[model samples]
Target: MDEIATDNRQGILTRIRWKAGYMNPALRRIADRVLKAPDEIKAISIKDLALQCEVSESTVTRFVREIEVQSFQHFKILIAEELSQGSSSTPPITDRHVYEDITDQDDTASVLSKVAARYAMTVADTRAGLPAEALEKAVLAIEEADVLGFFAMGASLLCVENALLRFMRVGKRCLFFRDLGIRKFSISTLGPKSLAVGVSNSGRSISTVDSLRQAKAQGTTTLAITSFPDSPIVRHADICLFTPTVTGVIGPAEYHESMVSKIAQLQVIDVLYSLYAVRNFGRAIEGLERTSDVTALTRY
Candidate 1:
């Protein structure tokens, strides 16, 4: 295998940690092994690494490719280079180990530090991991859509609410409903000129997936902001925007999305809103001024 140029790459380990959250069980084991022991990985052969991670040799190849490395040799070379440098491309979060979960043995200060680190890392990694092409398509869809419909449930709904508020200020017609029946009805009313965005970290939420499904059936452009690239939501989405799976900072086996996931999703929302506003600068500013004026009246 041809060696990948280490100089051309930035933060190989950071990329692995970011993408690890969305990986399948087998691939995740490989990633966990690599992140935990880069020095060991650099010295281990592919066959040995595969055996150690309890995955097949092919799964090891897939993990390397998923992180955009060309081959296992190239992956090890990069790890070796990173190790020789004596530091990671991404700065360390406090003095604590990366991806260390908050434990009950910690005090209030430790919790604060860990939570802050998680938030910072989630934002940085998410920004790095998002696909530019998909983001561009999502922005264009929003710019051209006659109406925008957001579908999410649970903590994911908080992200939707923030998007609704921000987009509304920029004069976008947005729809969101907490009630499933009402949300489904609202989504059903949207047709070809509308955009449907479903937010789900797991990508398996029944309501969110069904809402995207309903939108696609109506020929509305569908966009998904999810951690899992192959999740059910992606099957219905015309465009998919990914956020780093912040699961690294929390329990590894925790299936439910955490508060850190919301932070990551919120950052995606802010990016989308900013890009849309930039594309519609004049109208966006005017709408913002108008809305600000109206909202100011209610304040004091």
Candidate 2:
């Protein structure tokens, strides 16, 4: 917690949940209540919050420090900043999936609206959780690396491969090793001059975990793009960019892969690509011209 993550003026609760797994039960309860009822929490005093959460006043103070804020007042200030951005009460997690809560009785318009709301919130939350300093370092690492290795499995593979093509078209050396057998070998080839970017929506992909582990072992700079900041994949990363998702709907509560999760990860992909392209305008244009010329005649 040496580098405190202050609100880059977007939001801070999601970032608090990012490290929630390590929090004690009392602190975790406080974190949950803050996210569950932001507006109410805003109106309550610290002592009242302690009483409400059934913890002592000092426990309330500990919850604030667990999230890295200097004091309870500072933590509330960050919450106020987020609320000023227009999200009042927390939204319920219903209708996050088409199959789970949806039924034949549901109308078409209702289905469309709920799905749209889910996507909108997922992107908004992910954007809020982004740490500008970490994003800057990730972009600069990719831009300066001798090569960038893309690692992923299942649905996340598409996002990583898309990143490879985007970086390649912009004149960057990018690697895409789709076969699991060769993935670790390829990872071992990288060193201090390379960047290994692993995309894992769950942050528990076997291929992703092993590849990132090898990348770290070889001294390659590693970046993990995931929804779970405290997941195993993060253990091997030099830096991490967190994505937001419908995590509450997963596991024994109910189960399904979320479309919003994939879209959120893609938003991170687009952010990285946009930042790199802006930073290297001339080279990007040159590479685009070279690639477009080869396919230009086919387009008529």
Candidate 3:
């Protein structure tokens, strides 16, 4: 995955100063105070900040507006970004009393229930947010393409390989590439008559992004199935499909959020396969019969 550029405190302070130049004197003074002591101001309430700056609450509000942030809450994100860049050590806990109040509740049943609930929520959110237009476009692209290339890396590679099998069963010409080198080779060879689909939950996989780029350069229609539309993969894709997945470190454990995203992608492929079958009903029926005949010979 492509690394996301982290914003630092200096960067935020610089932006604030640049924006402050265009603001009225009252609003600019408020911005100057906040930028001068960002850490101190971050800990202060907006009301307290307004009081400290000797400005009306509206003036403080106007200051945030001049900086292009929605509100003080968003402005604090810049401060947090700055603090994060400077802090090598862990953050100090302000809520020590809460930690002391915690009792031993780490039962297996409780853990299982929480995990199941999180997974269920992921699935529900992904299904609810499925884009209808993107889904239809992907289905049509697969159905009409001379060849369909499926590319994924890490856990998503498993999903793409399974989808290749499913597409093959329905008489589609499909190829699945889990190997990075092979993926690049295939993309270079594929032509405009082909379609390339890549799956990545983070949408930052370098290999997946590179493969899509190569495919597009070769005149192939590129599609990206990912959880984030704002990711690098989306930029190179002709069609972008998305699913909902929470972003975080899951420790040394398997990622349940990514699993949910994979399930959502598979559901999309299933829908595409069904549509393709309906559109080419006679051909699909003939293919099924041929497979049944081969099975009959083995059974006897």
Candidate 4:
């Protein structure tokens, strides 16, 4: 989150001007009106705003998302907040410690504190960003699939492995491949009854996207768990679940080196596993207990 200038009358104008050049023609028109006449625009409906901008209602929706406001109502709330803050400057609400890299000078206390806070924010933002309807649909798809194939690359691969460990216990057929060539072969074997999950935060991983593409081609339902909704992976996915792009307060890289995206991805897995187990608790408990009992003999 960014700070607002409390006393500035033209804060909205400044924000629009800052992002205007980056926006296309349609979004620019929307931004211009909000910047030039914040009070009037705040009172208008989205339909009226679309007519004023000479764009479709959908374009207005896209503009709101482009501006990173959750909705048109949310954008108006921000404008109202700006108006209410007329002349008093407030302290920035965030810290500069986000996505910080570790250094030789750091001690155990600093490392622990930074790591804890980062996980806290990462989990919170991920929870907020996950679309509930999409999540339910993904869980249902997995439950109905004859086999579930997970596709991931590099560090992202670990997130899917975490899912594999949990999903396997539910007595469902799950599959993956560490080798890219082998992975594609496995994807080719899936059909309409299969579900392919492409796990990529950026959604541009060639191997992961390619796997989803092939899976879709075979009539398998594809689910994308990513931070980017507009990424190539989304095009191939039948359903898309977004995660928060939590790099840092200062706009760092795609994700933190400590694997905040991994945390986000794992959280989705946790939710899915929980939902699936609850839906089939009797079978889930039996499977878990049977596995536990079998493994316990070897453990002793």
Candidate 5:
């Protein structure tokens, strides 16, 4: 009806071209159900649609609102209009695609391609969805903190370690805790001037959450880089950066998702680091020069 709402509806259809990867969970579920049975949903009642999706009527209502529809009636009208115009946009692949791609690949190249594509998608999704204010908060935290502590469990530890090294090279006091006991002990000592960054793909790692909680309780600035926004860890964080997980059948092969999520986390950290270097370029250069002089005699 209104110009802004009209624009959102058109935008939603266009976003479908990028797949529904950026849609919130509730809206995504509704989109998936509707796309699967476009013809049937065009005439179905909202109550029946909720029953079919196993979600509440309010969820359906919220989904319609997300697409800028005034109500279910308008939503159905738009759906019918699209259908009549022969709209046949395909919904994005679900968890099944992740499993299917891995199980069906016969060559190393093909497997690697799929894995690379997933990571690329994660990066694109992360960049597309990242909010400007969150980026600014993270940058400011890195800039003003007296110390930076990184906590990550499982393979995510590797990404945190790399980030710690990068910051250290720029003369920032950075530490990565891979041991759960040591991490908790360290967190207890953080103060208002310190920053604690936790990385978890699912955002549900118990140890990581505990570490953040401890840090926050001590007045430390806590930030979380996670795939799930609803994760408990985010509640305690001063800043929350999200990454989209590539869902697949649960198993060892889920490592693919882990890797993609890590890339997204690292991209965020990279931006923070770049901003820090720019803000303190002169000081960083001086530190690099001093380090070079001390190590000059040891070089071959």
Candidate 6:
């Protein structure tokens, strides 16, 4: 239900930049050209832009809608406004190719710096792109739900497990299953008062998407945490939270679901958990105290 605000040029451009990496090969070609030459794009017609990108004119139209704009003219209008600002205070992300890949020749210091920068950008982009109203709705849904179910596969499960621990520590009833069959079966039991949260970096994982779809069929509120806004997972979610496309930007093809993306997903989980706790402060505090006291006895 959350929609990106398209009133400003920055919003339109930011969405394009964030989603460029994940777009299909044809769209990426178009996106790459647009970002590198926004000034040129403003003056060029859609037919010309398509010819330059070597894609069809329809693909150009699809790219505009993919960025959530109403039409190509609208897209060009926003770009013109951005250029007319005259200050050049804000620069487009695509102006240069800065995302670097780690190589065999890299030193520890180089790896550390590159990775640190990647994480920093992931956090910032995720924060900027995430919809405020969607987040608020997710937090409220978690707080009101009689029970919570977290679903995910592969590295994305890290976010699911983390949420399971954090929310459970605050005395909320939650469930997670590593087994696909168990997950599907458990989802079937959830009713209108329950919430189903699916975490997927690519948002195309069949297990995760189908789980959300199944949950929705059961009348449970569904939420999705993913990097792709237009992904298959969004169709099934009642509320959706999006992370920035980190792996898409820094590509070696193998890093599609890398830890860099996980950092963004985890950040979303941390914010959701924090907000839920604040809303039920007294109960959450008391639950934390009790859990801490019990766990303390296990410590050496």
Winner by TM-score: 1
Candidate 2 overall lDDT versus native: 0.75
Q: What digit string (tens of lDDT, one per residue) describes model 4 on residues 1-300? A: 342222122234334443443467888888777755677875899999999899999999998776556677877877777655642333244523344444554689988986887678667656654657777898899889999999999778888988888888778789998988898789888999999999997788899999999899889999988765446898899987766643421222244333767888899889999999998899888878878876688775
Give the alpha carbon lDDT tens digit for every residue of 1-300 in model 6: 133243362245546756664468899898878767677888899999999999999999999887777889988987777556533533344443333356555688988998887787777767767767778999999988999988899999899888988999999999888988888899877999999999987788999999999999889999998866557898899988877653432122223456778888889999999998998999999999989987798899
TM-score of each: 0.72, 0.70, 0.60, 0.69, 0.66, 0.70
| lDDT (tens digit, per residue) of candidate 5 on 26-53 | 6677777775566677789999999887
Per-residue accuracy of model 1 over 39-152 as CA lDDT, tens digit each: 888779999998999989998998988898887887887778766664543234554433345655578899889888777777766776776777888899999999999999
What's the TM for model 3? 0.60
Instruction: Show where candidate 4 strays beyond 4 Å.
Output: 1-109, 248-258, 297-300
Candidates by lDDT, descending order:
1, 6, 2, 4, 5, 3
Better of 2 and 4 by lDDT: 2
Candidate 5 residue runs with Cα over 4 Å from true position = 1-101, 248-257, 292-300
Q: Please give, for residues 96-195, the per-residue lDDT of candidate 2 as tens digits.
A: 4355345555699978887777677677767756778878989999887999998998888778867877888899998877778888678777889999
lDDT of 4: 0.74
Per-model C-alpha RMSD: 7.6, 7.7, 12.0, 8.1, 8.0, 8.9
| Model 1 misplaced regions, further than 4 Å | 1-71, 74-100, 249-254
Off by over 4 Å in 6: 1-14, 17-100, 249-255
Please list the C-alpha lDDT of all candidates, in the order they appear.
Answer: 0.80, 0.75, 0.66, 0.74, 0.70, 0.78
| Highest-lDDT candidate | 1
lDDT at position 288, candidate 6: 96
- How displaced is residue 41 in candidate 5, in Å? 8.9
Q: What is the lDDT of residue 92 in candidate 4?
A: 43
Off by over 4 Å in 2: 1-15, 19-105, 249-256, 297-300
Superior by lDDT: candidate 1 or candidate 4? 1
